[model samples]
Target: MENTKGISRARFLAGAAAVGLTGAVLPAGQAAATGRGHGHRGLKHRGVVYTVGAGETPGTAWSAARMRGDVRVIRDDLHADTIDVTGDGVERLTATAAEAAERGLHVWLQPTLGDVPEREILDGIAECGRFAELLRRQGASVDFSVGCEFWLFVPGIIPGATVLERVDNLRKGNVDMARMQRRLARFTAKAADVGRSVFHGRLSYAAAQDEEFEPVDWNLFDVVGIDYYSFFPQPADYVCELRRHLRWGKPLAITEFGTCAYVGAPETAGMGWDIVDYTKEPNEIKGDPVRSERTQAAYLVELLEVFESMGLYAAMAFEFVTADAPHRPDNPRYDLDLASYGITKAIKDRPDDPSSNWHWEPKEAFHAVARRYGRRAGPGGVTMAEEVRAWTGPLS
Candidate 1:
């Protein structure tokens, strides 16, 4: 995805104007909607939220403060402890986590999995161990798995890969549902040893009839994590799909999700619109702003309400920064220009920049949450089920 440089200021403003729909922004006290739902109560502590950004990028820290999120989710590979040897890198991450905690925010460590040119798998593990130790030393809690979409990074029967290569790669990685189960088990054990709370990140495959492709291994972690970015018009079905995963008695977290601007109605169609694409150019939904904001905000609000009502865990938005400025080319993670999803463009040091186009903003959604539920504790920390019921209404 290309940066918004060529996009004139007038065009950006037009796009924002198109999506500026009117709706009551619920306050913190009234944000939780009345819904009769039942699921396992997650950790009662306050939820940790973040906008995904480059690992340890200054933008991430700034966004956390701007959004008022309880935590900033960052890639583990970005940590100096993992990438730098002087141990100063780990110290920086620890300090960041400590600062977040002090501000009532937590830090979520996301370590990517792949063959690093400079570091071997053992080295990666050691780095992860050290990073984990740093979090512990800093008294920071909350951790999530790195990208577990091995199918995408490696090879798979997906449309992107050829059949032969996909088969070969799958065989090499043991990319079967059972293999995922085992891998998750080990990963969970490791993360638990580091922090009692953990989330396993995974991709949401095309809706399939079998559990294997559907990611049914939610039992492996305290929170069931999945990436959700739907191309369809209605989002209710996707929400239901997630609800099924929540049946595992764990909370739910969306590891990644954003509108792809370039994707057209037909898969083979050329890029008709240019925005932030996750895999390609024009990855965001560009046509309508009013419908877009309402749709997006409603989706998030509904999901948060559902999770709260069900006593499930929290969810984090996919990203905070845009792709164009200070791009990390060596990292495939930073290959695309998906930075438009950021509340603020990469250039501005401020939280909400009116200059760039945003799918969501910190002040709107962030304030809505803080106002409604900021003072109230989540199911994980609060044990008074009856009192919660009286406050938020009955849970089925």
Candidate 2:
């Protein structure tokens, strides 16, 4: 597999490892942070926007406040059914949605069916169906981006068919164009199904060539959805590639995007920690933290500008919170202890044995995004300070 940024997957992995940063585990908190930027002023666009998950964290809420777009919440583990929507969950999500709605944000409910154990698939679908119904009863405008990145999880074909293939399989098995239309038809036919819209979630894989392109059944959706990381070389490259697959003319939404940052323990006990470096060729530490964050922010700004210029419908950043992986301790898929893509760091406070893993913390890129989109507060408002400063120097 190749990253959209022109780096082959193997090369990117090897390069990343050489820098002392390892592991690209999908941060659940990253996915959950998708909805945090929904309500800020000046962040307006014609696109159909959405966020990662609907966790009721302050960080998530703050992020949503800065986004001038629609909101979508992952409804799998968080609120899969009425039983899961306990008093706490209900209150939290409801408050979150209400806050978003007040800021002109539309909420969509998304559910995934394939990543879990095979035994859980049927239960997942059923849970999704019920979850959609329950949210509707609550008078919320609910929709489902059912079965996220199905292609990424499907078995068979090559042993390592890349992440894109796995996501494609997910869609094919559950809701491709033909299947999606049928499902929608049935869903519409049901007598009591009044308030929900169901769309297929097609997570884009990191394939740089057409030979690796996985076909999507775009005809079955009311809206088109994709997850983007810093895979492509530039935002323009991504936009061009995206335009090719957008034959159906439905609105498009980016399900994810962000830079990865790794953290490590301090070199000396009482001394301040040294940032992991990723500069050298043969195992030299040269991880460019500042560059990574700036690049991510610049890419998002450029991408959003292109979407606006092209009159594309929707786009959402990857997420809001800095989350930790629950299953990382035992997983041996990779070597590194931390995933560095989150905007915030997750750190455990202790005197001597403080966490050795990279802590997840907000980067300047996060603030840059907030400012550029008019999602922040105060006098200067939401201006692209970084870009402006880069171009104009100090504004006497």
Best by TM-score: 2
Candidate 1 structure, TM-score to reference: 0.48
TM-score of each: 0.48, 0.49
Q: Residues 300-381, candidate 1: write the lDDT tens digits.
A: 3344444444444444443333433322223323323222332222343332332442222242223323332443435344
Which stretches in model 2 have alpha-carbon errors above 4 Å?
A: 1-105, 113-119, 136-138, 154-212, 230-236, 261-292, 325-339, 351-361, 375-396
TM-score quality measure for candidate 2: 0.49
Residue-pair clashes per candidate, as listed? Answer: 33, 54
lDDT scores of the candidates, listed in order? 0.33, 0.34
lDDT of 2 by residue, 1-396 (tens): 221111122223332233222322222221212122333322223222222333222233323333222223222211111111101122333444454433334444443322234334334444454555554565644444443433333222212244444433433442243543344334322211221232123211111112122334555555555544433435455545555435555555554444433322111110111232224321122333222344444544555555444444344443443322211223222211123333333342321222333333445444544444443222554334445465323321
RMSD per candidate (Å) reads 13.1, 13.1
Q: What is the lDDT of residue 53 in candidate 2?
A: 36
Q: Please report, as a residue range, the 10-residue window in candidate 2 with the lowest summed lDDT.
A: 79-88
